[model samples]
Target chain A: MTVPSPIELVCPAGSLPALKTAIDHGADCVYLGFKDATNARNFTGLNFDPAQMREGIAYAHARKRKVLLALNTYPQTGNWASWTQAVDRAADFGLDAIILADPGLMAYAAKTHPQLRLHLSVQGSATSYEAINWYHERFGVQRAVLPRVLSMAQVESVIANTPVEIEIFGFGGLCVMVEGRCALSAYATGESPNCNGACSPGKHVRWEDTPRGMETRLNGILIDRFADGERAGYPTLCKGRFEVNDETYYALEEPTSLNTLELLPELARIGIRAIKIEGRQRSPAYVAQVTKVWRAALDKLKAGGAEGFSVLPGWMAELNKVSEGQSHTLGAYYRPWK
Target chain B: MKLALGPLLYYWPHQSVLDFYADMAEAPVDSVYLGETVCSRRHELRLEDWLEVGKVLADAGKEVVMSTQGLIESESDLKVLRRIVRQRAGGDAGFRVEANDMGAVRLLAEAGVKDWVAGPTLNVFNPSTLQLMIDAGATRWAVAPEMAGAALAEVRAALPAPLETEVFAYGRLPLAHSARCFTARHFNLQKDTCEFRCLSIMDGIALRTREGAPFLTLNGVQTQSARVHNLLGDLPAVRGQAEVLRISPQGAHTRQIVELFRATLDGSRSPADALAASREWMVEEPCNGFWHGRAGVEQYVAA
Candidate 1:
């Protein structure tokens, strides 16, 4: 049997401390956004500005670790020039790769900065090999962040067919809907990951102490209600409980973060190029813990053959402690969940 | 201005879908978009049935176009899209292909087709993106449902002449698409064994708020607005922006709704009169908020 090459461990860094922490904890590459709406993780007071990114990139490069910049949000006609300039700036910075979602931005980067590497953001919504191949052929995107929607078998099939490198989400907040294609956020909040780089935007998110329960609404539309003792997750539209017929249940998906710890061995066996950790909106503590645990797991998988590898229980406990939904699922990776 | 019937976003029984198009053949519409752009499990009418339906509408002197699935997940879905592209590539069918997904766009690019409708799901927000798509072969493009009319006026002004613009002028707006099937989840079943529950809901299933306000509609893997997007009252704003107004199909009164829009666009019916007559045809509250540059669910009637 052939020995599987160790997969690159790409981690998220919302702040400078998080970037340093990820690099210290053995992340091969740290992906972050600017302090504006150019990237998907456009939260308040998170991510790096130009000077901060310049320092972060310098720190990562000095340590022989790579830095990825996300210019992922789709820009409308009015403010598209700003987005284009940001793309050119990323090229000038000499970053490892620029992750993007919009076709317009993708075209600009391909034409203007032909030498820079492009990674298709999950928000690109290229679920199949055919779509992945299109991005590769047209925009010269080197890798695509697979949406959290494919089964493991599907992922293998896509990898076998396409020349583009594969990047799968290893841990963090999971989007139940396909990224980029979803507008449930914008429908209620007038903002989406596609245009605004935020979903269930914090400005529109409000919690009220109702007699029924603690109700969370986005722009005045109810998302989820938590009982007094129940732990409330962040209010995104797809994760909310709503009335379908009569019984109000999670009509789209129950709140659960995707933790693919057990699939690391399988993912490595399938020759996946990188394992991406989400949640740049999370604190440095989260980026540290997630990167540390995944680093250990990947090391374990590499030490032994994939056939003898098993997920350590200690890693599971560490991850669930930081999980948003108070639980974890294999998500669409487990065929039954898909 | 030309009026195009958008592909049916909901799953219907084989007969009802056939009947809807039979009635549409005589309606005052310029083009007909036929196919399952939603879920692949919607097999009441297969690829052949859609081709037959397109033939009927084309015979009635309508420019028929076939649309591909918006989120192509599996190889099987791609196989179906390839067949649709091939059928038209032969140049015998004379059907225009709507590249809803990037996968479909890739296939269209491979076929070296003359023209395609860059579907609303394609997210063509700016003029440069639209221009690049036109360079590839997009003859007409649908504006994103979230896009404002003011933004569209700018994009139209930026673009060179001869490109047709279409807007989602009516229907429950298709807000999102996902791999997980909501309709199957409603019945407590997996997507693999979904039993085609969407067939029962002629229109998509209405998802009301806990407070009993209509919020969103679940159509298989796709989510749409509960309020129907009606732009008849906003005809003054729409007239300059779009050369074609695409009305998405609904369960009932679609033919009448098309005629109302046609009469309004042709100046035979007053905007207020059209809105008044359209009340009975609507299954949900009418809104033109997106065109007025506000929240999509709001009516935003001009003062």
Candidate 2:
């Protein structure tokens, strides 16, 4: 019997520099989206243009790294032309695959570009093996990016049942609810993660100085109020603190980064085909460091037991130096924190 | 356009629910979609009781469409879905089913049923997805609540001929659903052992932000906008695209809402008067932003 190589490290890059950095740092694949609502990271100063996407794909492919284009946002009813055009352009760019969430887009892609390898986006929120199998049977989806809401046991169960390749989020900002299904953002800012690729967009975010301390708000809803000397986290909707009964608490999720760096060996043992890093809006240097560390850790795990190699220390330290406030969580991978 | 009383997303008292629909029988709404769309734990109306309500509405000259649960968590949920798709009134044939989740779609499709309503929770954002549902058995589709009117026009343009499009014109917009029930969690109850506490709040309990602004409403596992979406004014603009307009049932003044929408559609009431009339019916503020591709909270006025 022969042991297969460990799961590939699929990373994210919001810009050309980040893509190059990730590719140089041993990323097996890199995923990014266009600079529009067609992709999920429809932020102010992130994502690629047509020329940049073409060049970025070439840059990654030259380094023997696959480039997956994220055409993940659900097409707005009348403006599906832009989404359709995005898919056509992605195929024309010789991209490795297009990660899709919408069933209509999947049907269109399957019909128009039958040869283009399709990976189901996590935004599809396909939790069960039956749902995954539905996409596989219907659209011939090559891989399915498992939503971050699932547990490792669920992942194992899904892997056991589905023939499609499985990709799990390894690091970055964690969503408490299933992706593309959540409307908490829309509840506040009128923009939603499902429709607009952004959750708690920076344009709506504000850090205000109050008599209490520093109050962080998104779309005028105060998420957190920090004391004078206390650290204030980014005002994301899910990470916000709210009063349920009389006690104030984090209603959605605690403000934390999802770091499963220590669970690499365990994940690899479970037949996960790919491990993905979730931040597409991070700096190039941040991408390089995380990718390099994970690459080294994965290589070490392949050699033997992952003894004396814990990504926790380096990952925590490096990420802290970049952006850290109070703590980090393993998200649904470990426990469902209240 | 025909009027569809969307699924009862809230948990009213069993008697109040019975009374509400009984009153709806006299209302101008053409169709009534009964059963639970929020959580299965909400047992104000069981399958038999929903069918019973359907009988009264049917006798009153209203079409009855039994809706399936949106978040099908367990095998019991699947069983409920199966019953909705299979159970027929008076042993004639199954009632028209509205498939909310993909499981419902799969169940109905496998049963060889060819006419169903694709519930808004199906997230049919484009024409291709709409066509897929139509091919699978859907004769009509309720556009996702968050979809803008412009986007809807595009979807309508690409839709296969004869498939009716229903827009969520009124009611508290269902924002999202999860396995974890916020209402149950509010009482510090685990989801599995939830004491059916969701029934206490006739409408969902409103969740306010730290600044004391209305943020959202929690109904079992489903989260909805605190602001009820009133698109009566914009109805004229997109009226051509929609063959049916859905008015979701609220706890209070639901019959009045039905009348207002009906009058507006019938040209008896102007959009401005209907908009003003809506204020008297809603428990919270109204928004029409998602219809304009703006924030869901912004009530955009047509220029």
Candidate 3:
């Protein structure tokens, strides 16, 4: 009998409770980060303290679950000490891998603590195989989280060219531009993902009632206006509606999440090492439900029957109920939706 | 420090493009970076026209460099990159190339070219990456717009000697680029089939925040801050840090902007007076926050 290939389910855990919930719910691995600028999700009341991280890693290790530490933000000049310390701490805590993007931090990790495995964060914007290989050859990056800007065909091509394991965004908020490089948030609000670890930061967001309906705004620009009784999506710059000529439309990207539940088999066939679920700020219930659904779908796919392997419609509906905007998109996997 | 005219992000008539450089030949600028760096659909000046203009700039005693498209989305884009590297090989026409993407870096290096400019789009953030590019044959690199002055200082200190540094001293900072065309989409057109609509707005259309505050400018796939970054005052501080100051091409009064930078750099003008004089030449309000390590839109004057 042939052995079934186990698909690694890399789930996000923003807090300790979420980490425990994800591990208990069958996540093969859980990724989390510190509660500061050293990590990308530098939101208030989320992420781990040093004690919490050490305990979280121990708990996951006891359960035979992997823990990946995200130290992904680009370090500010003259202030790389905090990021370097985060890498050192992650190595001390015995993380399964240290996810990093900055070239200096990558070099530091490679030199200071060579034992800790390195995974290139999507924030690195390793779009091409050559770029990925450059990181791998120079810094010994074992795996790379592919940028959301790539297509499935491009992903397959990258996997064929490079020796590193490839992880892709199986589900989450869609970044219209490549991560770490976008300055739209900083240009508007003075805060950016690269510097402040947030985009369209909540402090600058306001929803005002207009004569037409509820108008959603970010840094004082109209992102969307909902009619009476209509739903209002989160006001991000890319998802905002603007008047280009005479008519108003979504100038950048329509509000959507990347849900690739239908393409699991094709992705697996193409030799993808892992699938990443992207909402670390989400609640444990949402994480549990999404993780369980993907786990079931992936297990069924491994059983070799394409029949009866359809993505559960109810699961998708549940995802929409949580935080979907007007709809969900397959993102760059199927087609480029803007 | 010398003056380098950055690629013309705006679309102009064929004659205007020729005329702009013809005027630039007489300007005080030391180098001129020619070609389209925003949208590939802009064909006002193709490879041949750019080369022709490059020859004109070269003959005018300006160091001419050919810049490639910032976003390479298709096989056709790669072909364009290949052609650029081939044309500039072996000191042909005495012109260099500015690689906007890593693919361009590989192609240029493969063509056995020894010297090229690293355009701002490459996102060079650290010393090692900068050194790697330098080793690969980058003689000069325009620091990405968002990198603060403090960061620039660190990279400058770490750079191998003889590598010239340039800063985006004056312009509407080019923030981001993508496959989608915001200018064409403004007219309800698809990217592949959009009519050449970007030509209408010589300076990209201004974008405002929800509170009706001018925030950024949208030019096709490239998003620019609405505030034009005029670092005329910061020139003296960055003078030692950067070898060249890049002045992005705008609609009107570009020659005057170039002259102001040159005069200030040459110590013939005061930074404060030069900054005050720039208000007459800018298309929008001015900002220098990215250089100050603050919000890109916020203007910070050194005390």
Candidate 4:
């Protein structure tokens, strides 16, 4: 039997407990961010402080697992020092890799801490192999997490052309738009992933229970409304219902999570170097559950190859419970035709 | 500040495309950006056709620029990008090209073609990214549309070199783009067989919220704000930071809008009068909140 490639299972860790949980549950690496706007998941009560980061890194290292620091947001002019300082902290903490989006930050990291590995964040919006190769050539970017905007065929084509390692989002909240390239959030809320590292930032969100129904608004703009028994997903602008051509519908995309469990065999066959879970704001319990399922799935795939791999019912059941909007989609991966 | 006509975001008829530039050649504009920067499947005008229009604009003493596609996905897309870069490298086009994506930047930099405009899609938020683009031979950059005026002033001040700064002064704010064609999805058609429906609609199809509030516009893969983003009222403030103010082409009255901006900038027309006159030419309500560092949908009027 042909041997299956070892696809790395990268999990999310918003806190030290999450990091330890991910590693203990068999994650090859756990990615987290600083507790500030320097990282994309800059939500309150989430992420790690410097002391927590040090402890998390030590724990993962002791367990023979890797820890990645995500300093993914683009810095504004005056606050440029904060991003650079975050990079410095990553190097000081001896992170396995620093996931970044800003080219300026990349240049600084390359020059100041040459030894630190750089992984281009999805927020960089490098959708093509040419762009990835260019980053590799310029700043020595070792890996790139692709934005969820490519089909399976396109992803395979990109892998064939670039030498940099490719990591893709395998599970979690889905961004219908091309990351870093979208400004929908900024249009409605005056903050975005590129500037403030948050989309539909919680500070601006208001959920009100009224006689009409349960309504959620972002910056005073109505995002979505749900009836008594209907489930209301996160008020991401893209997933909200809107009117088009005199009909109201989810004009962009519905609230859903990306689940590539069924595509594991194909993903492994295509030589994806890593599979990243999308929520760094989720709880430690979530990290534990997802890490276990993915680890089990990867282990089975590695031992049995593509022919014997199958997504078990129990795994799907567990994944469905944690899924956003209580539903999962293949997202851009399974597009039969663009 | 110079008045620039941004690349036509909407697909028009072949003759209309040529005629529009011909009319623009005489309009009060310093530069005209040509080529299809949006969907590659848009076939109304090819590179040769764009070159023809660019030559006309060039003959009219207008600085012509060939803009590349924003989202590069397929091999064919890359091939087209290479052709555009090659034109610049050969110096046969006699016009500069705008690098919308990093792939284009890599091609232009590698081809040793210096002095390209870094399109707004490049996401240059701070001085560091802007500095890197300059090192890669970028001589000018269009600030991202959502950038506030305060942030623009700060970034421009911190620039290592004196690169020309352009701002999206007027247009329907392009909020997002996806691999999935939103227009196709709207028509319930597959993306591969989209039937070029966008050509029939001059501007994008407007999408509104259930409360009848205009929210977005669907143009193939791009999702734009339903409201037009206007910066005419902020021209006095914009002049402090930006060297060029770009006016994106709309379905109608583009020349009039250009004249209004020129007249206002030249002190022949007051800013308030120009703002009011320009509103008569717009397709939707005006918003400048993004320029003022607020929600892009809000129209912020300074006291």
Candidate 5:
């Protein structure tokens, strides 16, 4: 029997507790961001300060676990200084790699710190092998995170064609639109992942209870309204219910979580170097629980061959408890044509 | 400043697209971007058909450039890109290609085709990235529509030299792209069998709030702003910042809109007069908030 490649489980860490919890639960790597707009998950209370980053790095390094800093947001003309400073700190703190999306920042990192390892963030939207290869050639990127839009066949083709290491989203909240290119939030709220490091930013979000229904609006444009006794989700424009052709529906995507448990064996077979879980804004309990389940699943797949591998119901149950809209899907990885 | 007809965002019927190009050939625009930049499934006009249209536009003294799709997801899509890049080789049809994605960038670089335009979606916000793309063979860049006027001025100032910059001046702004087709989902159909529903909705499916407020628009896999982004009033602000002003095609009054912009640029008509004349051609209320450093959909009236 052919040996299955050992896939790295990259987890998210929004806080010190989350980082520690992820490490304790068998995450091979944990990615966090600096408490600034340089990273995409630049929420108010989330992320690490310099002291926290140093401590987190020491803790993970002691346990032989890796730490990757996500410097993923696209910086405007005046904002490049802070992003490059974040890269400087990442290298200074002895972090394993920096996940970046901006080409200018990539060039800066490659030129400033040649020894610093770089991974292309999903926000770069490098959907094809050629795109990934260009990043690899341009900046010597060690790995590239695949956007959650490609089918398994497409992923396989990319892995077969490129020399760059491949990483993919294995679990957590899904972005319906292409990450870097999406401007829906900015069009409505004037804040976006590109310019402001936030989508559907909290300052623009409003929730109201009315006789008609529970209404969620972003920047005065009603995003979704739920009937009595209905569950409500965050009013991201793509996931919100809108009237189209005189009918109301989630015109882009229904709120759902991407769970790649079934594709673990296949991804491993295709030589995906890492699988990242997508919630840096989540709680520590979420980090620990999700990491434990994925760890167990990965262990089982490694122990057994593809013929013997199967998605454990118990793991799926644990993951479903934290799923968005309380629903889970294989997402775009398993195309219907296959 | 020059006028450029941006790549058609909507998927039109085969003859309708041909007719639109035929009319564009006579417009006062300096350049025309030809190709399906939005959807790969929009095969109403194949590559050969676009080349044929390019020949006609070239004959009419319009500089024609082929644009690649913004979002490429399949092998077939890559094949079409290769054909487009390769077709530029054998003949004197030496037309520039605009790359919206890095995949197209790599292919163009591999083909040794320099002097390409980096489409707005490539995300060059700072001078460093713009410089890198310049090194990677980009001769021009369409400034991101969401860029604040002040920030764009900063980028222009910091640029190593005066690179040709294009401003998106008209049409419903393309807000986002998705793996799932919003228009298809509206009809409860899978993307693979989307039934070409987007073709019928010329201006795109208007997405409104339950309370009857126009919020957004759905165009197959692409999401757009409901309000047509009109920068006719802000022409003075972007005059020196951009060398060209781009007008995305709408179904009606596009040629007339081009003439008004040309007149405004030539100082024959004032910005206020041009704004008033072009208001009739716009499908929705005009918004120039991005130039005024506000929400893209918000209208910030200049004093």
Candidate 6:
């Protein structure tokens, strides 16, 4: 067994309670966004406001854990000031680092707060080492959260080349597309994750119950319908079934969550610096359960190394309960999934 | 305003691609961006062939620009990109290249290519990113396809310096790209093992919602809108924001679409007249709602 360097467990915290729960569950760091459209999870009733953000930071810092602020959305032309202000807020709140997607925002943060650390958000759509290095060269980005598209070998190759620390999605809702490059949400609804920080924004969503099934539509575009006693995932555009070549199916991808619990040893062996859990829109109970499971898995890996590590059944069951569609996949990490 | 024929986003027969550009030699377009911007597996026209095609267009009194692939997934893909960058910067220095992704941007900037087109996939929504592109030596940049007219105006107003702006004026809007090839998946084949099925469909295969509403078009890895995004009706507003109007190449009647747009820009034809003339040429319905800051699939008409 090889000596494993401890990898940071970056958990999501949508609220103050989630932040504290993550820290208490042995998260090395908890990442979150603000209440405004400046961050990716700009859903109503989600994310931290200024007071909660300050409180969350204090809670994490007191426990010797890091708090990362995600200002991961691209600022529109007229709204550039708000994103810049968000960067300033992160610095003022004494955040351990700012996870940013926009190069323009990164430029602002790098110039204004020279002391603050920056992690390239997955929304940055940086897949290769060259792209990550460019962000590092231009903005002094210390870490990069890679888009969930690379295979295992590709991930290893990227980590081998770049000095910037690499982070990969370990668990959560799967985005089949390269994060920052997608415009499907904009096509279906005028709002996009890159511009509006929300995909299939709540305002555009409409659900109806028919005698045939339960129907979900976004911007009047019928996304999906669920039959009686059938599981219905959130009607994200990509996950819905569509007809291609006369057959109706999930043409892009199925409604599934990415679970990398089985690949923990391989990820560690490849020298990934951090493992990220994606869903700030979820509940605090979810944060607690996932954080606890991941914490246990990571600790077990640390104790036993690659040769002895194995994912426990209880941990898998715990994660499955909260996974989208109550199912899990390795996503693009496994070559077959691609 | 200038008209540009964007790089072909579909796979076609080698002869058809050659014939298409050969036809473009006589078409009313100011710039022709030549390349395999979608899948790198498409080698019907290699870098050398594309350069040869570029030379043909250049000699025909049209500005030629080569575009790199939007998504680079493998070492071979990067190698191809590196070769394209080297050829553009070194031997084929007469024409410019368009950087589609940040990888291409970094490569172009690193190779000291001073003047290049920042393609739409670079995601330049605000002026700061556009300014950064200018600083990195991009002489021109295309606005992301989803940017409305008001947002475009706002961005243009806030430019750090006068940079050439291009807009996606016509054709099916490319909505998303992924690692897994939807085309291959449709054929029930793995990406590596799939016989190039994208070659069969000159245009991408149509994806409709289960309710049979035309929704998206699935190419190999890229997903596009089922409806063609025609901004010809908004030429007056677009001309105010962008110096060049880009028309993405479609399966058929591209030259006619280019002619109609050219005539509209020259004021020989009214936008409504041009819109009516171009309707039969489009594979799908027309939509300009994205330009109006509405859902892209919608066609909003002002009362």
True contacts kept of each: 0.61, 0.39, 0.30, 0.76, 0.77, 0.75
TM-score for model 6?
Answer: 0.98
What residue runs in model 4 are displaced by over 4 Å at the alpha carbon?
A1-5, A336-338
Give the C-alpha lDDT of model 6: 0.90
Give the alpha carbon lDDT tens digit for every residue of A260-310 in model 2. Answer: 878887787778899998889889988987788788888878776556455
List model 4's recovered fraction of native interface contacts, to 2 decimals.
Answer: 0.76
Q: Where does candidate 5 stray beyond 4 Å?
A: A1-4, A336-338, B89-92
Q: Which lDDT tens digits does candidate 4 get at residues B94-197?
A: 67989998999999999998889999999898988898899898999988998889998898888766789999999899888888888888888878888898
lDDT of 6 by residue, B1-303 (tens): 889999999999999999999999999999999889888788899988998999999999999998888887778888878887887677545578898888888988998888899989888888898889988989998878898989888888887577788999999999999988999999888887769999959789999987898999999989999999998887877888889999999988999999999999999999989998899899999999899999999988889
Instruction: Report clash pairs, candidate 1.
Output: none
Question: lDDT, candidate 5, residue A9?
Answer: 97
Q: After superposition, how far is residue B160 of candidate 4 from its true place, in Å?
A: 3.5
Indicate the worst ten consecutive residues by lDDT in candidate 4 chain B. B86-95
Better of 1 and 4 by DockQ: 4
Off by over 4 Å in 2: A1-5, A210-212, A217-224, A243-247, A261-270, A300-326, A333-338, B12-16, B40-60, B72-83, B86-92, B193-195
- Give the Cα error of residue A154 in candidate 4, in Å: 1.2
Per-residue lDDT of B216-300 in model 2, one digit per residue for the tens?
A: 7778778888898998888788688799999988888988888888888889999988998789889898999888877787778
Candidate 1, true inter-chain contacts retained: 0.61
Per-residue accuracy of model 5 over B1-303 as CA lDDT, tens digit each: 889999989888998998889899999999999998888888999988998999899999988889988888888989888888887644555678898999988888888777889898998899999998888788999888888889989998998798999989988998888777777778777778888888957788888888878888888888889898988888888897899899999978999999999999899999889999888888888887777778899988866
Weakest lDDT window of 10 consecutive positions for candidate 5 chain B: B87-96
Candidate with top DockQ is 6
Native interface contacts retained, candidate 6: 0.75
* Residue A92 lDDT (model 1): 86
- RMSD values for the candidates in order, in angstroms, are 1.4, 3.4, 3.2, 1.5, 1.5, 1.4
DockQ of predicted candidate 2: 0.38
Please give, for residues A58-162, the per-residue lDDT of candidate 4 as tens digits.
Answer: 898988899999999999988999999999989998999999999989999999999999999999999899899889999999999999988888899999999
lDDT of 6 at B149: 89
